[model samples]
Target: MITALLVLVAFGSSAQSGYDLWLNYRPMEASVRATQFKAMMSHVYFAGSSPQLQAAREELTRAAKGMLKTAIVNTPADQAQLIIGNIDQIAKRGDILKLSKAERPTGDGFIIRSVTNKGRKAVVVTGGTDLGVLYGVFAFLRHVQTNKDLTNLQITEHPKMMHRILDHWDNPNRSVERGYAGFSIWNWHKLPGYTDPRYTDYARANASVGINGSVLNNVNANVIMLTPAYLAKAKALADVFRPYGIKVYLSIKFSSPIELGKLSTADPLDPQVRKWWKDKVDEIYSVIPDFGGFLVKANSEGQPGPQSYGRTHADGANMLGEALAPHHGIVMWRAFVYDNNVPDDRAKQAYSEFKPLDGKFNDNVIVQVKNGAIDFQPREPFHPLFGAMAKTPLMLEVQLTQEYLGFSTHLVYEAPLFKECLDADTYAKGKGATVAKVLEGTYQPGKLTGMAGVANIGTDLNWCGHPFAQANWYSFGRLAWDPGASAEAIADDWLRMTFTNDKRFIDPIKDHMMRSRENTVNYMTPLGLHHIMSADGHYGPGPWTDKMPRADWTAVYYHKADSLGIGFDRTATGSNAVAQYFPEVRDHFADLSTCPDIYLLWFHHLSWNYKMRSGKTLWDELVDHYYKGAAAVQGMQKVWNGMRPYVDATRYNEVKQLMAVQYDEAIRWRNSCVLYFQTFSKKPIGDQYSKPEHDLQYYRSLHYYNVPGLGTN
Candidate 1:
């Protein structure tokens, strides 16, 4: 009786850890544990010698141990019920070729099929290569976990995107830019001497979600990273992650010639500077053979670039590209460069700088552009550069960390944000030219085609600070692998794997997860409002702030609120930024009648009494959105409260506490935005809604500085 109680208690505890993520191979209850296949796995057959293949075997062993609660043997005897291998090993067994005829040639393509050869009850996980076999093994395990009968299964899978990567903006000092969870996961001080086990787990988590590469340092790079000492550290991590088919990348400081090489000038046009980078690239490749090349942030936000030396972005990118060309590595030069010095519209800077240089980039260089033109605000129209630079291979860069949307405090699922950009019709080549097509290299994937998520991972036991924030990491990987994947499907799968697979839990939580991003947008920056957060911490609302040095740096510059009304005007009459988009879509945004209502405030400023499509005036609509946002968060709390029985006490209570924080902050946002904007309208907030709890001055005076658990210090 005591043993029974202990067993129940142990089972109860595993349900708590979000560590299982999507590969919770935990055994089902006894009601279904006695099924035929559970007994059929009497022996196993796995054949391969590469590290990737060994990793595949280890994962299968771990899953078998967890689900079957027994040791699985190695040899392929008659009683062997499960077999996993590449096509070469599987075909050695007679007549299995009929089950899967042709072997795929892609490095990471897989085929799983049920076969009857020599009267054996066998399931084969075969792929074109070792990495493919690993993917095949993961796919098979997912099938098992989802309760699919493996008796007669045949499937083949390959990723649509060639390079799915995570760009970690982790500084050498153990800080992550826009990282909300915790300090950097890479313990640089201990590395090269001590290889943290967390590195392998990180690689495993990334590999499971189809992430193929990781840029290990901040794009605002440290020059010391190029030294041999750090190269050895990077090599140590590369060795650990290699087995999982993940390549390590570095963010190259563009001025490394000046910082490290003692060069006179770090000019892209100078032969000395060019030779310095070439030697550096050669040194990096020597340490790590499959080193996924450089991520450069230059000429933006005070970073040194070709512009500093009177050269173009292409000149700087191509110089590095030429150096890496021999090693088959590429350059991901960031297109987030906008003038911090100019008083012009920040939205128009990137477009103006790069559009003229379209088709000028070398084939080995990809321009990494953010989802929005501005820094990752809660909401903004898609970046004008998405379609404008048709000739240059543009890689999509998304912020997985919650930098602008309440950091780690709020429960915001970011699949909607990713989907918003991916699904937007760029109309670059007439209509139907989506950002996904641009990413997949289908529209233009030849030179470079990839999507990079600014990583949110940290040393937290749960990985991301909020347990639910894990969904953003998962969602980014899924979308990177296949840009057309359904956000709802990803959310449902995540809930089942992260928590219980119970319909009651999955249904409501999925609903909540799907609506969470929109809820955040409504509260923080709904209707195209952007960058109105508190100046330093970016934690709370500051819609009334306009005292910054540059006009575009002020909240007033973005929203343009006054006695007249609210929102920036970027039309031809204002900034002429609308002309940046291809005329097919540009015309729609230029004309108020055709522009989508959601973006109306983004591109135009109107009178406070201008009637909206919903029959409310502009002022009334703005207030209504703020009120509705607070109510939505309240609704989310109630929904989460009902899910107590579906998860364990620890995680259940942690999320509940965070949800409370989100609710309180959501109301604070409502109060601050409505009250600040009301000062401009000089209109009553109407007795139906609550008044500001505190005045604008009080809100502005409240400062949250250097908080440990927040982002981008």
Candidate 2:
């Protein structure tokens, strides 16, 4: 009997192992709110028989059983304490619900309100469509999970963007590009016949946050993904996600006609190539009727594209767009291209290539631009393409994987980084043209708007490798759903739902999460220093990395440190990259006196003894930021150590150990960068600062092998 009890305990613990994400639905403590929730949820009336409706019913039943510890009895709509369905299904009881026509939710939106029906108190969860009703159910559960009062609850929500997507860089072989977590969750060898239960859970987690689409494979395309055998595999995953409102998309090889169909040429303008693409898209739709569309990465990093045939980006994207248009599908064409042979600033390449072709793309094609001009640096000013491309629909793509920010070991909450980009003013129309507004199509109505996060998920027990890394995934969804949502509030809700609602744990931990991104920026790439990470895997500090086949790929190309000064010069006399933005924004960045300290180095190369706003030399200020950033990681360790009683032992210990690793790496970054850059500055290592543990050569000689997330091109 004792042995059986031990097995049961282990099973119970395993069941709660971060696998459920924010929907764990742990039993509520005895309280007035719990009693009220239990009473109200004792009987539920969920109507309709659609698959989405069934999914909602199952979710509500599961949540009730877990949180309230009671089985909900199916009751007639008139007698039930809780009524759930689409608004039209419950229109007969509209008198008590009192929903105004203006209050009615449009698109994938929902409304939840408390009402009285026939002298009985009831709460209604509903929307305009079945998918909306499903979203409403999750919102209602989140309300209860956060311990919010339900006495007079009234809530209305609608997604700000039309398409919220997770772009998984999982390869056909199960290796993920820049994935820090374990192997890809998709067991391709076993898929199309044996669907993992984890796939269903992934859909549920995404649905809970209003994420509606997913691209299944790496942007670095595989020809096999477009073949019949693999299309069937994608179809199986789509079936699991359909009920949750997630439509599956795939990344395609641009030259598939030549490789797969044995065609002589794969030029977009060629009649044979166009016919092949059209037939392939039709074949895909026959298998997965609701396949969202294709995401293409072309003419960048050796990926084949229209440029190979001397054709424009539009020619290639329009060819795919024309094929998918008949199926009501869209094509997401990435704007991350940069020619290595070009002598211009690498940051300016994407804008230069795509800006002129803004109105040239087909209606179904969206120019998917990265959040910043460069790769996902620790921090970057908003991409200039955001406000410039007025005629074409643009989708904001941000990375959730911690590639350059310490690869899942460091506890960095990325909500602030996301928010920083969203909140930046573009000065497109006037003063208040924020990137969020541009994404919402506020200035140009009736255009498609979307956000895509490069997923950090994998086969780890916690999904994200680091326990705290899960918060970045959660934040991405929330911000994608509503760009104006508060990062702090989202962090607070995640903490309460994922761990505990205790105030002691909530307040300090929330502050730590909010500060995490900035702390990482300070230690890794402080003051607009971008992309100086070690080559290939980008695992650690390598500010001195200069030798490479392409000059733009080296660290020395960006920082430009010399005996005179440091930083990339983008002013009129330099690359003139600042001219890409609107006049107001260009002026702010182009003028040395007006630029923000955070972005000082990005736009100007400055003297080592240049006096900063704080009356310190540029070298001194740089040193101070590095020291403080490393110290902040120690502070994070202290914060997590104090929360041991609140979080589960498995997660608590995991985080505690990861925190130790981050602190050590943080020190390494500080020492390596300071010592290397000190060579050019000829400055003293201040007495107040911590001395480097090893000489610069020792840090430079260190090489890491077998780093996770290194994908083959």
Candidate 3:
């Protein structure tokens, strides 16, 4: 009897350490909703019988069983209480839901309505295609999970972008570049024979948020992936992801024709190279019919490309685009390139190289540009290339992995960061021409539109290394589907599904997440100070790392701190990088008086005694921001401590321990930056904050090599 009681107690208090992500349907919270769901969702009449539909059926049944404690039964279409299928399938029955002509959705849109047909109450979920039907099911489940009443449901949602994708930086041997999570989830050696169940779960998580595609390999491409043996392994994974509406793409080495096919030259203008690519593309299509095309990282960071043969980027991209275009696929030619030999600003290289060749790209080619001109810094001005490319299609690339914002250890919410870039007023087509509008084809309607993120997924039990880090993945997919969606609203939705929906828990936690990005910025790269991460590993602060293989690779090169002042002046008197933007933005950012203080150091160097808007000197203001950010982490600890009653013990404890580490790291970042910068400013630490524990020489002597995600380990 004692043993039985113990077992019941353990079962009742099951721990959820975030393995399920936001899809954790943790049982019914409201009795009335449960009863309504049980009554209205008993018999599901699904007309389609594809593998995609099978996945949807299983998802609905799982949610129904978990959320309503009801077993979903399959009944005839005429007698069922719920109906799900494409529009054509529903139209054959006639007047099932009586959806208005104006209500009809096209593309990947769907419609979910609670209707009455022949005196029988039923909820009909129909879409333009089978993929849309699957999306509708996930949407309906979200509504149920969020405790919204489904009595008179009317929701019509279609993706704003055609391709919502995740770009994995996974290497062939299982190393991930800039991936702060664990190792790559793709087990290349075990593939073709052992299909990990986790692959299906990965697809389900992405599909739930409207993400439709994933590039399986790193942009720093390996030519071996094009070999027959690797293609078979990729086909295996693609087959598993097919049911969840995901199309797998690959990153091909630009010199693959020469390296893999033993051609004399991989030049785009060469006939043999062109034929080789066509044959390779055909081989890929045969293996996986629904295969997406290549994502090339060419002529950047020593990656081989057409530049080696005096050919342009468009020349390289168009060659691959022509090969994939015949198969209804595309080529995502990366615009994240820089010149090591050029003395010009590294930020301006991509714009100068690609802007001239914008209109020259083929119809099936897209230039995938990074959010910032520089590497993924904690804070950066939006890339000027967004509005500059009028004739060419450009997709915004944001990093979901925390390479610069404290890796997987820090609790940094990235929705606000993404929204910042998307909502920036480019003034390209007039006053309200936002970056989001430009990418959505507002100026050029005939072009394809899309957004991509560098994925942080790996082999950890919780998926993302940090439990809170999972929210970045959720936010990326949500924003990719609809750029106009508010980050705060998305955070609230994720919070409700991932944890508790109680107002007491939601209100405070949402506030914490919303402030997280800025808090990290303040400590790591406040007031436009960027890319000061410690060498190669980028694990911590290293502002004094002045010597490296190249001047651009060092922290001192960008910050340019000296005895006179600090900052990289991008005004006409300096590099004139601001000229890349529209006249409105160029003038505003160029003027020291007009530029916001948040980006003051980014555009111009200032005296240490210069007065800030806060009426404090620049030195005092910088030190204050650093100290306050570290203190905020302590406050976060207090907030999490108060919500122990609401969160599961496993998650609560995990976050608590992690927050403790974050507090220490926050202190490390704050002190190291302020102390190092002080060497140049020749100023004392702010009176409010404590002095650094060690001297500048002491901090610089510290070493942290062989960190995870550097591709070495």
TM-score for each of the candidates: 0.95, 0.98, 0.97
In candidate 3, stretches whose alpha carbon ends up further than 4 angstroms from where it belongs are 1-15
Going through the candidates in order, what is the number of backbone clashes in each? 1, 0, 0
Best by lDDT: 2
lDDT of 3 at 705: 69
> Per-residue lDDT of 1-713 in model 3, one digit per residue for the tens?
01123323544432354767888877886578777777667867998887878888988887886677777989888787789998878888886866567777666789998888667878888888888889888888888778788788888888889889999999998999888778899999999998877788888989999999999999988888999999999999999999998999999999998899999999999999999999999999999999999999999999999999999999999999999998999999999999789899999999999999979999889899898999889889999998999899999999999998888889999999999999999898889999999888889897988999999898766778888999999999999999999999999889888898898999998999999998999998888888788995888898888889888889998888888888888999899999999999998888877898878888887788888889999888889899989999889889999999999987888889999999888988888899889989999885667887887777788787688887831
Supply the TM-score for candidate 1: 0.95
Candidate 3 — which pairs collide? Answer: none
List, residue by residue over 1-713, the lDDT tens digit for candidate 2: 01123424654553346666788788999999888778677767886879899999888888888888887777887777788888877776666577678987776798898988677888888888889999999988888999899889788999899899999999988999999988888889998999977888889999989999999999998899998999999999999999999999999999899999999988999999999999999999999999999999999988899999999999999999999999999999999998887888999999999998989988889889999999999988889998999899899999999998899899999999999999999999999999999998897688888999999999877789987788888989999999999999999989888888999999999999999999999998887898899985798998998988898889999999999989999999999999999999999998878999999999999999999999999999999999999999999899889998888887788889999999999999999999999999999989998799899999999998998999763
Give the better candidate number (1 or 3) by lDDT: 3
lDDT of each: 0.82, 0.90, 0.88
Q: What is the lDDT of residue 486 in candidate 1?
A: 94
* Global fold similarity of model 2 (TM-score): 0.98
Model 2 CA deviation exceeding 4 Å by range: 1-16
